[model samples]
Target: MNLSWQTRAQSIAQMKAETFDILIIGGGITGAGLALDAAARGLKTALIEKRDFAAGTSSRSTKLIHGGLRYLEHYDFALVREGLRERTELLTLAPHLDDPLEFVIPIYADKRRNYDHPLLVRAGLFLYDLLAGKYNIGRHRRISQAEALQLAPQLDPRGLKGALVYYDGRTNDSRLVIEIIKTANERGAAIANYVRLVSFRKDVNGKVCGAQVTDELTRESFNVNARAVINATGVWMNEVRSLSADLSDDDKQLRPSKGIHLTVSAERLNVTTAWLIPAIGEKRFYFVVPWEGRVNIGTTDTDYHGDKDAPGAVQSEVTNILQAVNAYFPSAHLEPSDVISAWAGLRPLISSGNTKQATTAVSRKEEIFTDRDGLISLAGGKLTTYRLMAERGIDLAVEQLRDHFGVQAKPVSTKQIILSGGGIKRVDLEAHAHKIARAENVSIETARHLLHNYGTNAEHILALTHEDEALKQPLLADLPNIAAEVIYAVRAESALTIADVLTRRTRIAMLGAAMNCVEKVADLMARELGWSEEKKAQQIAAFRAEYEREYLIAR
Candidate 1:
């Protein structure tokens, strides 16, 4: 059930003739989750994305599957409970992707922070552990100043008393989203990337029925009819909503906030544990999490009133992160040059003006909107709670179906249904995978990497190598990626462009590489994808242009 160009063309052909039970507009985690839920519930489902899966904010997350310790500061008990519960569920579902990560928050007796900060933080951690009762990995503990310094000697010793060590989950957000799409495909949902929803379709009664979609790659237009059309475009919800005819000003929903993150080389700050610094200006604070062998420092929560598609990190936001981390780790002495990458994500929050004066004040809770014409839009939720959001969304759609078509849908069964790699539940999967690889006549290192990425489905990847030895060779000399992976992505994952193959299908963009290695990998992918010489040149130019825009350009 791998989604390919042929599958996409078939879906378009079917959409032109008949109506689907459910047509999901955004192919992100939420949209993909909704499609899986609907299809699992016996509904004919279809999902479309204008770009690659997770091309938007889902891929740009802080890459944490945590209970959000800072939410406790605002006394958000319910949000904390929901996030903690979802965090544990994700860890259980994807152990290979979501691993235990410890964070150390220094209890500094600074003039800025109240002297009773340690007690406050301890209370918060206690509540966090309690919320994650059965799912708790480890309890929070306080370490002495000497012990804390031993853990991270690079810290500034001025007024450093002790620190709190608590456990949470870290994950590769893009990989998780890709797995979700894979799981949806396994459940019989038709998915197409690089397809844009250009217009909306309505029935004779003027009720919302379907969408006129265009394949961005081929510039071919087709119409899809469905019992319900759901717009799950995160920050672009409003843009999609405008396509509906019967929507009014009152139904206009969504207030998006941009959060920026800066990536510094791990060598810049050689610490083992992640950090939660009480940064100035913000009501609570921000975090400096260590992820993927790099120091990921981020997240400035400010209103972004700019273009949603291409939001750039401002100079002030970068300065705020550098200044805060510098206050504690003065010895790291980080500067702009140490940054390998910088990214920004927009959080699509529902604005309830009476309750929330600012976007950050609004709950990250999911909201669903259905006009009189039945144009449904879902917005405002974190990646951790995507499944829960989907459950709610599908239930709402089913109710709409009963009213409109006099049909009743079956109950959702995704709660017990595991995802792609999550289907197998084993204790020592690492050792077991090695044995399987030996039987398949592949290298142990290659086997381990495949298992980490595809779980039991690693067999499929290796089988390709066994069939064609040339496919097993690494794509680039410096990278660990296999040449077969590029073909796999195009044939199975709907990677229409070189950027989709390099950036999302494989992590060539995120993985720090030498300048030549980056260009070489891009060129390799271009060749494998059968791009023309001019196209290959264009891709290299585009990759370099993006690099300069993100890293090299001076503020």
Candidate 2:
């Protein structure tokens, strides 16, 4: 089924009429993975999301698919190993979205990381590669200070010792989740965004059998009967669990830690590889990643007590990030003016210790809970390990189906759930881009951009350009995204609102051109999606407001 607005009506009918073998709540990467796993295993599956897929942490990730290399400092070898293994799995399953990259960590003789000598870094890197074992992308090596400067001219030269270079991976986190969702739908999973779970519908014996839900767009409430209901909501797990029964307030399973990131012009930050820079205080750290045409400097880990739905980086947080960037890259001279975009994401870390203390040390390990009432809830995990988390969550749900529902479903078979954009090897991608450029009459850069995000499906986008020659033009003068992408998002990617296109479907949001071309983007969307003039204005306003509220530095 094409995952478009047209298909949503049919999906809703299915959601209302069919009894599913497994119904999953939450459309983040974890939930999407679960739906794909269950459906691929020959179980009747359906998924519901209160908002858009990846509206929460799934879209707000640091945009990396690497193993948890930092976890090694605390001796969490198993966690690192599982993540490393998943990294290899993702690179194979979706080669285009998740590509391997070299990460440079420069050592300073007078910096706070005094313990990180060249030999010590080598030992850690060796252990990291050992954990990855056969799945390792590349081996780590030591680089002289001069060689390090050649890669990143921004690196501070004074008191700088040699650097350590290691291999990791990067990805468009939200795009990855959306592709997984589309694959699940193609495999017969009826998944709909903006359909929210209202409450639990229980049997006379008080075990979960179904749920009451409302479509947010239409506000029509209905019942969805399912043999097993799994709550995979990230930060909102507690809220969904509360709907089923009276759980204690003290039974909070998620401690949300807010991590914020900033994007600046790549020309200003200037780095060939991602940089791991240690923070000066709070025992913190951040990553300087090369993303799109910008540099992403991020991630302050502080316990977030604010509203989870509207997490934004405040001025002080922005100042701290720029300070870190400038301190590491003394010649970069970055300031608030240099920042193109800034946003915050709440990490749903599982609290295994004192909840009253800081959330910085909480584990990234995920846990699945089966309530005595038969409601299952999942919390805590990283984006890189989402597939593994789904496998484990669905395994337990399959057991529950046999025990209570009498539905004998097939075993998990998602190890082969080829993402919709799969099968494009790295070596083949360049030739594919050249072919697309020649056939579509677009720039090599634009063709490469489409292939990177849509992989083999780039042809589908190219087909749109033939119908409207104007669709080949760039969405913004400087951005690589073209107008055909907006139509593609509406027709193939199920993007509903302006936020869905600019924020998740395309790179406009964090790539820093959201405000500059909102009206142009909205006009194209209105023509394709059949929006009224008022709706177009509303969408433009909402997209601009979202950028101001979330992506802009609140100075």
Candidate 3:
């Protein structure tokens, strides 16, 4: 019953053989969440991904479990309250994966930015805290200019009018998706990546019954017969909806927007807490947050019309982000060279689905629409609200299953089910990290890194490290990850490619450390998966291409 990585063939075989109660297309966060929720309710569910899980927009996010603080400006209190509620549930659901982090919003008297007025910012924070109600981690407060400078140190001091500190939950976007997928698999959902949906299988009335899917890995095609089919592909939902052939609507479904985020050395642009710097003249703001040992900093939202598969930040975008960061933290003076890695993802804001005229007005509220062929497609949501999105999507599908399709489904609250690698309620994570540090003879940083990434399941990795001394060797001096992580990825986490292992499974690539130890990682994966020299070489080349595709800012 191996669900990931080594079980690709087995998983595919089961998918081809079984007639599923629900078939999910697109393996991003939304699809992954729907799969988990449906399976938990005892539905025979199968999910397929054309590329990899979280390979699209899911993997590329600002990585925050937002409380929707920004929505306060438009007086969208309900959205704020909903996001804050989800934040509370997620923290309890996966503390190791999602945790509270402080944010500093520096105010400058010289530059009139959005919410620059101390009283105004404080009012918004007050609403933000009030909205959180019982779930609030900490109340937002106005800090003295001296205190603000003490916290950030690098913030531009001229005309500084103090700052306001607030709290929000940050996450590893890709890892969270993988965790949910694994949890769903544990609850009995047939899942496979690198499997493309060729087209929808429809009945005489053109209602989708299932789909014709291809194994991208083997170039093999098969028919998956399902009672209900879901399009949870996020940005690609429009393209997926087009698969119904006759189910065509000229009215565009999604108003796609591209956002790019870049990471740099913490030493280069240091911050203990996340910084929410207001992008001057722009109503929205920018985030320069501390992640691992680096600062993840853009996310300029603009209408995107380009290749959806591989979208990278161009030279100007990169320069713009760097320039903004430098303005906020003049002392840092970060250059393009300081950018370790950069990547972009398109937001699936549904055009026809949106009630608001402006695209930004769509925000994170998700919309679900059923095609004439009975294909359910979801669009326009953010990572923070994914769990609720899944719960709602499953609720609709379950109702359709019973009333429309004559199948029975009674959904239980997913809020109760702890995600895979979670459920360490009583144990103190910090204390555990210290204990593992002494036991494994590794630094506290390395121990904490493992615990945060893998949760309680990190024990398997620790055991591997103790079993083999060489497995304990760190991949890079800057990165606390070890060779055991790569081995664990292949054996457990469905890391069929070097990019999956480095980029998402362990996040070694995000830190700009993956390329440094590609040979070692490849060797470790080969040993576990039994790859030949030629195959390994091809994998390496593919990873190199992906890395460049993501990070190479065309000048």
In TM-score terms, which candidate is top? 2
lDDT of each: 0.76, 0.87, 0.85
Off by over 4 Å in 3: 113-116, 245-252, 353-358
Name the 10 consecutive residues with the lowest summed lDDT in model 2: 111-120
| Cα lDDT of model 3 by residue, 1-555, tens digit | 335565777778888888999999988989999999999999999999998899999888889898777788778888888889888888888888988999989888866554456677788888899999998988888788899888888888888878889999998989999899889888888899999999889888777899999999889999999989999988888788877754354565677888999999988876899988887776778898888778898688887889899888998999888887888899998988888888888898866655456656665678887767788888777788888888888888888889876887764888998887787752589999999999879989999998898899889888887779899999887778988888888777788899989888878777888789999899998898889999999999999999889766655
lDDT of 1 by residue, 1-555 (tens): 776667767776776787788999987888988988898888888998987799888887888887787677668778778877888887777766776788887887774642235777789889999988887878999998898899788888888888899988787787788888887877877788888999988889888888888988789888888989898999998878777753365644577788888877778887778777767543545677876556788787767778776676767777778888887788998887677677788999777544347666777767887877888889887888888889889989999888878777777667676777765554667786779667866566666666666666666666777778877876655555676676677677666666676667666565544344555555556655677778777877776666555433137
Which digits, one per residue and each the tens of the lDDT, describe model 2 over residues 1-555?
579988887888997898989999999998999999998888999999998899989998898887787788778889999999989999988988988999988888884753355567678899999999999999998899999999998788988887889999999989999999999999899989999999999888898988999999889999999989999999998888889877775455678899999999988999989988877654667899998878898888888888888789888999988887788898999988888888999998878547776676677888888887898888888999989898899889989988876778776567676799887897899998999888778889999999899998888888888888888989887878998998999998889999999999886888888887788889988998899999899888887888788788766
TM-score of 3: 0.96
Residue pairs with colliding backbones in model 3 are none
Q: State each candidate's clash count.
A: 0, 0, 0
TM-score of 1: 0.91
lDDT of 3 at 406: 82
